[model samples]
Target: MNAENDLIKLYSGRILSLAGDIPLTERLAEPQATVKKRSPLCGSTVTVDLVLEGGKIAAFGQDVKACALGQASAAILGAQVIGRTAEEITAARDQLKAMLTEDGPVPEAPFEGYEVLLPARGYKNRHASIMLALEATAEAMAQATG
Candidate 1:
């Protein structure tokens, strides 16, 4: 297949399937912290709300308005964020940034679903959108912990 076809298949297949795993499509009733991040490149946006208890995430919700990549990222985060400490979420965010910007390996287990987006490293335009979820999550966690 041509490069373009490969990119399309990568975006349309495993990356898109991850979107179906997102569970926090609605806003939380009473979150301790909330943060929204937008990608200037594609105008993709993600808003995350979270509650923390004993330094770990106790509840979470999100309003995602973005491309398949962004949605999939949010889905992966949503699936694994509960019970995670702020430090863990921050590490995942930093690791995701490295994976996208520095051609690093996918994040560790629990956040490893991001491996499906590895093809995205070659598509710079999609990076911001893909990072929105992790960025928003990190910000929300910070707000809760700060």
Candidate 2:
């Protein structure tokens, strides 16, 4: 699975990489729903924004200052959840947790872009960062749907 390259690509080519230097103010403007997540251990923070139209995400954005994994997760989360519904977002979030903890099934292909993050599961500190985006995403969806 060329874990190194996959992780590298996740960080380099993914949208999160572009956020490295964006001012916090600029990063906070995209979501119709938003939230701030923090990892007390590493002090990673991510603020996610989700804009929904007719129950589907019309736009997604975030302003984050955190580790590579956190930012990458946010980038992937923003991209993948764009057209999915709130219920789907919740299921995906649950799936992610299961996959990360090795307590349940992993996502199948096409959706398995998440496999790239598998390596992160072993790094305890990285776990929170990786999950931050999903937590924020779920929050956004709940707000949009309710």
What TM-score would you give candidate 2 relative to the actual structure? 0.74
Report every candidate's CA lDDT: 0.87, 0.69
Question: Which candidate tops TM-score?
Answer: 1
lDDT of 1 at 53: 92
Residue by residue across 86-136, what tens digits does model 1's lDDT show? Answer: 789888999999999998889987999898888888888988988898888
Task: lDDT for model 2, please.
Answer: 0.69
Question: What is the overall TM-score of model 1 with all chains considered together?
Answer: 0.94
Q: Which stretches of candidate 2 lie over 4 Å from their true place?
A: 1-31, 108-110
Pairs in clash, predicted candidate 1: none
Residues 1-146 of candidate 2: C-alpha lDDT, one tens digit per residue: 68777566555544355344332234435457787889889999877777788888777777777787776666556556657777777777788788888755655432456666776666676778778877877887788677
Clashes of 2: 3
